[model samples]
Target: MTALTQNRHSPCIGICKLDESTGFCLGCGRSGDEIGAWASLDEAGKDAIWQLIPERLQALSVRVRLLPYAGGELLDWVGETIREGRGTWVAGAPGAVAEFPCHDRDATVTRGEDELTAAMPKARFRLKGSEKLRAFAFDGDGPVVLGLPKRRVALPMAEVVTPLGPDEAAIDPEFRDHELFDIGVARRASRFCVRTGDAELIAALRAAEGRHWTELMAKTGATIIEKSPHRVVETGLARIEVFAEIPPPGGTSPTGPHTHLLAEFLTTGEEIPAALGLPEYAAPIAIFYPGTPPA
Candidate 1:
């Protein structure tokens, strides 16, 4: 059969509900008119409509039922799909659907519904138990789609908070601790460091090597002092000397001095220490010498 013939099939994945705001079906991302006229439409017409489904899905808000599976169940499903070389794995519940492409040999999915919870080998998904809850995944190196279950009434697009870029991040002193500093003599001299015990961030840094590491560090608004054998960044206030260093066997970071390259900081330009308003004493900082201040 020709590719075009195969393309004639419907895109529906069983869930059938219209997003009132956009008048698009959540399952197939098709309008009522499009769905009704699908049979009458020519191949060209169908092609045109198919072209719009992705955009419609991106814009429309649809709700789906949650899969009542434990963390292990979900993880097992993901692992099986990957092992079987399934091009895509999809799960649906009532009015919702979640789908992802599975091809990586080393993708890892852990149990957690928190943001930046882990390195997320390829993609990270978080789910909370609530009828009105929406499960989403990190847009790392893969694509993830979740048809969130929301109230019957969907909010206007204008009300949604669009993410800001690194350049557009608001200047807030609250993120002061996230700042990097330069301090040390000899081998550590002129190096910058940001202390953090966040295992997720550490893992991400370790995974992002070479150009990926460089690009990730650039988001910190830090000056690139070095970028070859090891990456060194300067945030005017401090320097990152030990970026991407893994912790010891117990997962505890070194006591003296180290660097952190958190994915949250790279993507959102927000520092956890600053957002939590942690005190200087409790902040993630590793001074070279006791009582010695950062440069």
Candidate 2:
């Protein structure tokens, strides 16, 4: 099938206003380059970016309040708050619908339009028309509405809270390396869920905490179920301690403190991607890992 024939629909809304402070278009939640390069990109690239939009929108649309309790990582604390505040929703393919509560068996869940179903366990349902299959859940108390297209994707996820802001945004290079970019991938996907109001599917994300991204991938088998609430730290800006290496002695002999060189570029005075050695149109996160570990 042609590329256009196989994929879902385009996500652009045509508003096209770029937000300079965040480097994302206020309308579509995409970078200028992404908007310009949309036609040239393959379906895979489009899908990847489509997945990232919701997270960006979530960060921009939602209000993040720092939890008062201090201890452990902030993301972990946020995760705990989520688990305490909401119920758990698990996402998985049952191989056959028989494994789950069918419409005939459970009146609460009846199949809706275009293979969409409603009232499943924990208020979760499956979504169709994508290259991959997916599902979602929501807090029973709030309006059971899903957000999309217009920018607002969904309500506050019961189990995950994304702390969004320039000060709260940033990447922990150490943690990123530990997950090997898998968490990075999952973070975007989780944001998509949060934006789209897929609570049950997001609830499934709780399982990935404290585990390596590879392990989570193995456990889920590429079903698009991995999740982590911590990626906001990687996405937004925060006080990141950029360490630098001490140069060798003037005599051309290596210094005793020389382990490795780690350099980070930052200008507290302004927010510009170019200062960080990135294209003017690139995402602020495009230059996230610039240098090595400090000596």
Candidate 3:
């Protein structure tokens, strides 16, 4: 019932997610900081994770599967959608799409079978008589994200990438069973923290904002800049946001970090890197090139 529910045990299930400032997922049963601090927690400290589980499970009631598709299907993307090939999300745009790894390589959220494809650019995808979709590029055991590997322990694997779209919250009313893995969700700026300071770094960010933003999101206009307490890797002159949802290209604006863009990453966590150095202002971070630049 409360944090004191000892005998029955809290629903933590071993995954302890701390607040990002701490490198833990109060949700996933891991600290936002995965480095030294988490490694240092003793059993007693670890057992307290038992207390947070119930609160998190209550939140999972809204989890949905992130299904990947080669072309736009009857499905609507409730969270985010990645366009893999060169074509646009128009009538028939196909290269490879699986609700999961469709985004740029660095932005992969989960492992899926890339089973579908569009025959040509602007070729609307057809679920029937279409190319296959597999989550990974390789025939077997495709790619795995380096930092956060898919939890070795498998939970229920629901079939989301099938004919039906992710069940809408309005229609399904009951969705406690399906939960899209919130991998890197914390790294999102709105979902986590973003630090700013240092004239050059800030200026560079502002400049980026002024540029690609319009191209990233569908609409145009700048969003306010905000600073927060969670500091990921702050050394002398720089800190960083680990993840972000860059807007799509050519919606509005001058082209740069769109004010409405969602940026998420780690800060003030136990896993903070020591070899950290300031990010070079010379170019955009990985978010800029979610896929290979048009060459």
Candidate 4:
């Protein structure tokens, strides 16, 4: 059956604010340069950036949750009938403290929580086991908000924390079902541009050499830098390729021209055909890394 598809668009939220510390936008998780040049990039570039947003947001959310609580005060308004009793106090810097109401001229003076603890050097809010203070009120003061506000939108914990692993082709064969993985695979499968500049290696890879040349090259100290499956129309076939950059070994600074290390799968099409028996679930057509060519 003939297929019909519509054009794909970008994932820009427009609420762009670059966080200096993380170098990611608070809303879109894109670098400032990426945001500025979004319109000019091809589909591949846009897809690459889009696939990273969810992972970035998950990391940022975790970081925000673990930040120290800023110090707050207990005002005079929170007190009931005057009674000399101890109460718990919290802050990011200072540990927990036992605070007793000091009734002198019907006035209350606020001090850093750290002052009560000899070990603590700065004022901070701390909580004990199964204890959380959503809001704290002073005897004569307004309620001060504490800790990170609850996340309005819930994120899937599994997707947020779980990684796809080093080799996408072998990591989890079933990951495509996941939204994050699906988007990531779509990006890789759809990308048309490659980062490598070696034309010789590119031509060799395009030719589909019959023999597993990467294994023969590996004995010479070559290594695999990156490897992934290139879908049809992206790399011309459903192929798992090992991308490597080989620089001349010994006293060489990679300043001169070099060959790219590549290993193509034995089979072709939308899925890896099981007919070819190979180790590590892949057949190495060519292999190269940061070293001189073998023999």
Per TM-score, the best of the predicted structures is 2
lDDT of every model, 2 decimals: 0.33, 0.29, 0.23, 0.27
Cα error, residue 184 of model 4, in Å, equals 44
lDDT of 3 by residue, 1-295 (tens): 1122122212222334455443445434334443235446654554565345334433443121111222222111211333332111211001111111223223222212321222221111212111221111111121111111123212222111111112132111342222211112112111111232334333433343323322312222232122211112111111122212333344442121112222221223212122211112111011111232221
Error of 4 at 122 (Å): 62
Ranking by TM-score: 2, 1, 4, 3
Model 4, which residues run further than 4 Å from truth?
1-7, 62-295
Global lDDT of model 3: 0.23
Winner on lDDT between 2 and 3 is: 2
Residue pairs with colliding backbones in model 1 are 63-95, 64-95, 64-96, 180-238, 181-238, 181-239, 192-239, 192-240, 192-241, 193-239
Task: Show the colliding residue pairs in model 2.
Answer: 137-199, 137-200, 147-153, 153-195, 169-236, 169-237, 170-233, 170-236
Flag regions of model 1 displaced more than 4 Å.
Answer: 1-7, 62-295
Q: What TM-score, to 2 decimals, does candidate 2 have? A: 0.25
lDDT of residue 69 for candidate 1: 23
Off by over 4 Å in 3: 1-75, 78-289, 293-295
Q: Write the per-residue lDDT of candidate 4 for residues 13-75, one digit (tens) a residue.
A: 344577778888865677888888988887667667766766675665521111111212111
